[model samples]
Structures are given as C-alpha cells and as structure tokens.
Target: MRFGPRLLMALGAAASLLAACDSAPITGRSQMMLVSESEERQMGLQAYQQVLSKEALSHDAQVTALVDKIGRRIAAAAERPPGELWRAPRFRWEFKTVDNKEPNAFCLPGGKVVVYTGILPITRTEAGLAVVVGHEVAHALARHGAERMSDQMVAQVGATAAGVALAATVGGSNRRYVPMMMAALGAGATVGYLLPMSRAQESEADRIGLVLMALAGYDPREAIGVWERMRAANTGKHTAEWLSTHPADSTRLADIRHWLPEAMRYYRPRD
Candidate 1:
C-alpha cells in the first residue's frame, strides 16, 4: 500500500492521537497515554530498582510497619472498585518507607509505593498515613505518570513540526535562531499546558484517594485534617496553584471539603 507523503503523515498523526486517548477509572477523566500498561510497569520496575539501589530504605521498624499495614489496607480497598472494572488484580503491590527528609510519597505503576520518612510527622495517625498512601496509589491507578509522558511526547512532536515549518519559511542565517525559538516554544507549552494538566491530575488523585481511604474503613473526614495539617506545615513555602504543578495546600483542602459528602458514603468503619 503506497501512500503519498502528506497522506502518510496524516494517517500517522491520527493513529498516534487515537492510540493515546484513554479514560481513567473511577474519575472517568479522559487521559492520553502513549505507553502501554505493560510498558509503564516495566519502566516502573526499572525505576524502582534504580531508586532502591541509591536511596536509603527506612530501618525504623515502627514506621515501616505502620506504612506497610496502612498501604495493604488501602490497596485491598482500592481493589474493590465501586461497581467499576479496573486493573487492581494485575498489580504486584509493594510498599517501602524510604529514609528521606522530604515530605513526599509516590506510587509507581504496578503498585510500587515509596513513602518518605519526613511525611510521617505530618501524617501522625494510621488514618492520616492512609490519606497520603491512598493519594499516591490513586496516581498510579489513574495512570497520571503515563499521561504526563504522553503529553510530553505530543509536545515533542509539536516542537519538531514547528521547527520543520520554521526551516521552510526562514532563510540560511536565520536558521540558527530556530533551535532557540523551538526551545522557548517547548518551555511555553510546558508552563502553560503541561503544568496545568499535572495540577488537574493531582486534584483527581485527591478525590479518588478520599474514596479509597473511606472504603478502607478510614474516616473520609480525616482527609481534610491531613490536608489542613499539610497546609499548616508548609505555610510560608506554598506556591501559587497557577504556577506550580500541584494545587496549593489551601486549595486542595477546600476541594477535599467540597468532596467530603460523596466520600462519606463509602465510609466503612474498621472493626
């Protein structure tokens, strides 16, 4: 099947866009994912191995046990979707606490979760820990990382197209400036579009995490407390939501409050 160059380009672009279009579970939000689930898991496994090799895994039994216990409970709850089909069974869930001072936690694809030791002080209770862990888990379940990668992939394609167009329009000496102009365009796309997409993903994770924790028999209302404490903990250091890849703590807390009633319906208090 021989096709013209323009026809081939059009077909390739259409296929790429269609291949990247997917919907997130629970939230039902549309996502673009250039990578397959298996591919994402493989990348996650490699990243996990690399991280564990370089970073110090926590030795504190008490913290490690707490994180593991809460993580399992949340993972179990997340598996039982609310009448929605999902990819829980395929996950090879693992939880590890890292000996880091940063108040951060993340769950990679295939359920590889890492909790930084510094976040424990803010997440003082088991339920509080669930809030953080559940949120990280939600990011994985929602495939936000893959979506971000897809967005970057699309941006790279756009940059390449723009560079080609610039080359066709500009003269010899002016061609030298095309690289710098393309760099600026890439940066502008990242700051204007990609950052906002990331922030939206963070908000979606917050909403889904609340439900997961609630279903795990943790109090949904406690999510607010967790964010409130987080807000207080990072008072002077908080970035404006528009400028950062995450919603400001106060904004997150507000959204959590708004979504509490719905999350409450899933609350199944632990016996």
Candidate 2:
C-alpha cells in the first residue's frame, strides 16, 4: 500500500526522533540532539567570539582573575566520572569578565564563559561566585544548547507537517486559514513543549550546579544565599514562570534548598 503524505511524515518524524535520542550528563534526562557535538562547539565558539568582539572586557585584573579561578575549579568539577554513560566533552575552557552592568553570566558550548561585572556584588564571596559559575558550567556540561537546537528542529518539522496536512484539508478556497493554523501550531509547540523543556533544563542546571560547586569544595548551601541575593537585586516586576525560560527566583531558591542535601554528599571542604 502506498503511504499517504501524513503517514509518511509521521514515519519520518518518528525515525528522526528515535535516531537522535541522547541523555544529559549527571541527570540522565533523555535529550533530542540532532546536532553533532563538533558542530555545536564550532557554533558556540563563533558566537562566543562575536559576543567578545561587541562587549567590553573587564579591565579589573583582580576580578577577572577571580572569575577565572572559580571557573577553572567548577570546570574541573564538571568532568564526568569514569564509566558514566555520557562522556564529558574536552572543553577548551575560557572565562572572560565583561564590563557590562547587567548581572548576567552564561557558559556557551565548549566552555566559553562570560560573566558580567555587575553580578559581582550579588556574588560577594568566592563560594557565592562558585554558585553562579557552577550553574553556568552545568549548562555547557549538560549540552543544553545542543538539546535546544534539536528541539527547534523538531518543532520546525512539526510545523511543516502541520502545514502539509492543512493545505490538503483546507484546499485553495480555505487557504487563508493555513497561516492561522500554522501560527497556532507554533504557539502550541512553544507553550506546550519548548517552554516547559526550557524550564526543566534550567532547574536541572541548578541541581547539577549545586553538586559541581560542592565537588569543587564550595559550600552548596551558599547557593541558596546567592539566589536570595539575586532575587533581592532584581526588585522589578517579573514575567510568570510558565511564560519565562527561567524558573521564578523564589522557585529557584526553593529548588537549591531541596537539592542541597544531595549535593552535600559530595562536599569535601578544602583546607
């Protein structure tokens, strides 16, 4: 029997999904990863370079050194244990401090980390800095960027399939409705799948970050305080957590508290 377009599209999507199945490090959460690691790293490097070219690097030697120190410690702690299902990528880790006033930080794929100077006040101590660095490092270590790209690929495929199905059903007379249907599908995918996935990844990063900081000899409990300070720092109105990619500050703090005990098991304070 000849396969219809809808049936064929379904099979193709299923096959692609099955072929790209991978797992996140530490958490073992299943991930869709159509992009190869090498490709992802190349993209990350390019993006990192682009950001550096546009932003002013911090000239404060002491603060720069501190970020580098903490980043190195956390990067070391991000290595996977021997025999783990997911092998850690060999990252050419580079940490830079930007002079921007925004309290933001991120670790791109292959361990390119950028920390804005404004976050320093919130991070006050070395341990507190570890909380931020560890979380950012966890994002790279877990390959979240690649997973997100994969999700977008899937979403695009879904939209295309929906378009195909709608075109056939609606015909040219009702063709005007196609764009509306596609828009609705896109929104549904964003709200129903992508947004929730992003929130989950953020929370996962928080949990893994706690463990990394603890393993690096930083007190995991310090994470709670860091987040609390972060919440305090941003006194402006915020978007609802469901619509935002990040968990609400209060939710993030609560999660760190809950994960503290698990992370404490890995804690071995440095003398």
Compute each candidate's TM-score over C-alphas.
0.85, 0.85
Off by over 4 Å in 1: 1-4, 85-89, 159-189
Error of 1 at 261 (Å): 1.2
In candidate 1, what are the lDDT values of residues 78-192, reduced to their tens digit?
Answer: 7888766465646788999999999988876668899999998888888899999989888878877667755665566573243233234221332232233223212344577
Which residue runs of candidate 2 sit more than 4 Å off their true CA positions?
A: 80-86, 159-192
lDDT against the true structure, each candidate: 0.76, 0.78
> What clash pairs does model 2 have?
none
lDDT of 2 by residue, 1-271 (tens): 8998878877765665676688886678999776667766766777678679999999999999999999988888777543563576688999999999899898777789999999999999999999999998988888887777666655665743533432343223332332332232123446667888988998999998888888889999998888898888877867788887789999998888888898998899995
* Candidate 1 displacement at residue 247 in angstroms: 0.4
Cα TM-score of candidate 1: 0.85
